[model samples]
Target chain A: MDAATPQLRVKRLRAVLQSVRPFSSPKIELEQYHTAADLAARILLLAQSHGDVAGRTVVDLGCGTAMLAIAARACGAGVVIGVDTDADALADAASNLRALEMEDGVDLVHSEVGSFCRSVAKRPRPAGVHTVITNPPFGTRTAGADVAFLEAAAALQPQVIYSLHKTSTRAFLLGRAEEMGYHAEAVAEMAFPLPKAYAFHRKSEGSVAVDLLRLTREPPAAATAAAAAAAGE
Target chain B: MRLVTQNLLTCQVKACMDTAATPDGGFLSYPLKVVPDAGGLKQVASPFDEGVAKSILPRLDWAALRKTAAELGVAALPEEVPAGAESDAGFLRSVYALVFDIHLEEGNLLCPHCGRAYPVRKGVPNMLLRDDEM
Candidate 1:
């Protein structure tokens, strides 16, 4: 019961989230492949190690059932917001938060990734989010969905972002992040397990090489000016 | 929505940002008012960590939280987080309740400036703006 350490909390979170069901819809081009609880915990742990999650505000884009969001909260994030367009996923996330007795720390928002990002961007700088940890669509079904999530997340200019993407897109993603004024680094690579959930998945379980990217925003001119002002220039 | 989130939320409508600027040229949302439905208030217990709460205290809009808390009939929150509140058990419990326990299951979060209403249904606030507003 004493989840005092980050490692212990991650283990507890994995067990709690494993029971939540993934939301699926054949209509959407992006298939709803749930991120394994262990993987989610690992990502949270990486973010925590980098001083991103603990006592910071975190936003999870395309948060299906809020696996990552819950993990972020368990890792000591002050507030975790999980944004998803799927009503079913949001409902499941709500239930899971209740189940974990974490309704207070985690919030589930029903909105598209772009809308949520823009809304957060519209807030004043002080209210701006600190970090974004998302496991977005791999773009297997939708050619550009993953990029869309990246674009929106970059717009918020969070201090740090931890994103999961297909390893094949590493080069393109790095280039894209550089152009968007962010430094992207592939911090970890793992075999992402794909459980057979849809009829199209021939294998009962498959694995794909995926990369966990840590992105830090390049300081904007305004930020530079503010920093100077703070230093009493 | 709890005061924890309400403290962070503001009118996302573009025009509301300008109104947030004070006469002294400082930026602060003039404490967004809430129309809470008492029937929809639900208390869901969550773990309370004093350290985490203390760490987040500096980032909170105390004025906004006080106003919102008063509106919700939980006026115990002080106008300012008292000195050494980190070790204050009563303060921590009150903050814990305001932040994590008090859930607004249904209501409208009205922007004091733009007058736009973000509806809360089933504990989720719909922050989507109108097309023209965006």
Candidate 2:
């Protein structure tokens, strides 16, 4: 990883920042999209289970600041596209990546998850992505964020999709996945705090969360073929 | 959980009660308070009953959390997390508002397991199960 963007670029960034700095408010005004190493580890595990991350193309939906993108590349993703509706979050993510010289490792795309999925669907096959990783919003007021991303990743025909969501959202997410004819092979859950995220907990209450989730389809015979061709597997 | 939702979902625990109850005989009791956090002052309302927030908060659906809290006919939240708004405060913040700030002083949490009713008294939900049900 080398400097991909200019240094000294001062601007508001979004959620990806929380990953860089947790337990502190972002100095710049913008939403924080930070991923914890704990969450990133889950994404990496998904990639490891499927194959490798270093050279594969990964589409990150609701990719708040490319935290997973950076992690994926570090693990082995060849090219990581971080997609989000927030330009500021994307810009911030880009800046963070640039600062870390991870620009070559990832690309930040400004678009809604739905539109991004459609665009990816239009691209040529064998684009080097066998996986789609994302951390979409789980607030029900905004329904379908995860579903839309999953549909989009499905369009890309990836072998697996690793999305982050609250454990409480399992019913909706799993229900929607089944309704859409998508297969969910497993759900890995645990109690974890999302970094840089201040979830007020009552002294009287205990809280737990599943910061990461991996929803993958079996590698298409085609994917195995492609990967085998690429790696001489 | 949203404060608004917390007000409704909390069960009265001291009565040796369960958090959720059926519509016929169930009631909820919660006490709410708002305080400061790293980012800003926060509001957390939980079921006055200790047993309530613990049992139900983990199970709350994010959407219903909004609907139950905003039962007073509040406006729909903005598309993006607006500054100074509840939703913008991140997931935990939102959950705090839903679970901690809003008082379940007079509500009942519907049990996902049984359709029986639990009642609230003095901002506490009586989630105690009957001998037969237990």
Candidate 3:
């Protein structure tokens, strides 16, 4: 495979990502949406270019079917942990990993995103998660569910987080990010195609404008102080 | 799941979520006991990468990994990571194999403090807590 060009690399990555199995029976309440391979590939490629994916420990909160998790591994992330509340989604994720010969690169954990983050926070040692990439529920069913996912990702203390959110909520999430001590910006805009997976949908297909929001953790107080001292010298 | 992932997991029970440690000790929730069913433990060799191993070394809880490795009877690890272990090729290979190559296909991760069992099936651990437990 002559993936000398970035375009070729993305093409190859997308080809593999297309095989990731999506939700068998997506639940409306959980907002289990299948992330298109193209979008996932683009997001992961962007993260990789930013030095956030390769050799970095990544956590995919709300990892339905492990789309982003698998992509992160494909991008050379050292360790990828996919946490989902739904066991069936995780089953599909496992199968996807096996079919792609990527089973060893990622681990699936059956837990709600918030619960998993809480556990990581309580551990005596840091979980060493460096990046988090998630396409969370868009908050149509449950109010604040999207923010809840963001909160969980932040709790993991990752260096950077790439999350998908409705572009409409950009202002609110950016504010929340600031409150949480993260410097956030929308890095990419993409349309998330929604195939009719639920009964409530009026149309057979729809698309929502989403932003690939990147949240970088600000330097800790101690690190900032040390940097300031060094600069003074 | 891989032992590398296990090294990061902890009991998610509500009680366990609020505190860093049990009153008795600071390490109760983590390094969950790995109890593999008959023929559940397996290994698939992966290419060793010294850079990746060294990068992950700082994130690992050496004590927890040693305890978990000991419990599973997989490999022996020193009480402490030796000096310059990061640069030592032999040390990196063993650690990489132990953490990344081993897999728990079917088992239970029992929380030492709460006795709550998180079942591992088909290489994925179900860490979800029941509503009441949550």
Tell me, by lDDT, which candidate is best.
3
* DockQ per candidate: 0.30, 0.01, 0.76
* Tens-place lDDT digits, model 3, residues A120-220: 77787677888999999999899999999999888888888889999999999999988877988877788999988878889999999999888987632
Which scores higher on DockQ, 1 or 2?
1
Between prediction 1 and prediction 3, the one with superior lDDT is 3
- Model 1 lDDT per residue over B1-134, tens place: 77677776666666766556776644444455768776878887776777667766776767777878777776656767799987887777678667778878888888877778788888888776677776
Give candidate 2 regions above 4 Å deviation.
A1-19, A22-33, A123-128, A192-208, A219-233, B1-134
lDDT tens digits by residue: candidate 2, B28-75: 322212221223323333324333323333333444445444553323
Identify the candidate with maximal TM-score: 3
| DockQ value of candidate 1 | 0.30
DockQ of 2: 0.01
CA RMSD of all predictions? 7.2, 19.6, 5.7
lDDT of each: 0.75, 0.47, 0.85
What's the lDDT of the predicted structure labeled candidate 2?
0.47
Q: Rank the candidates by TM-score, best first.
A: 3, 1, 2
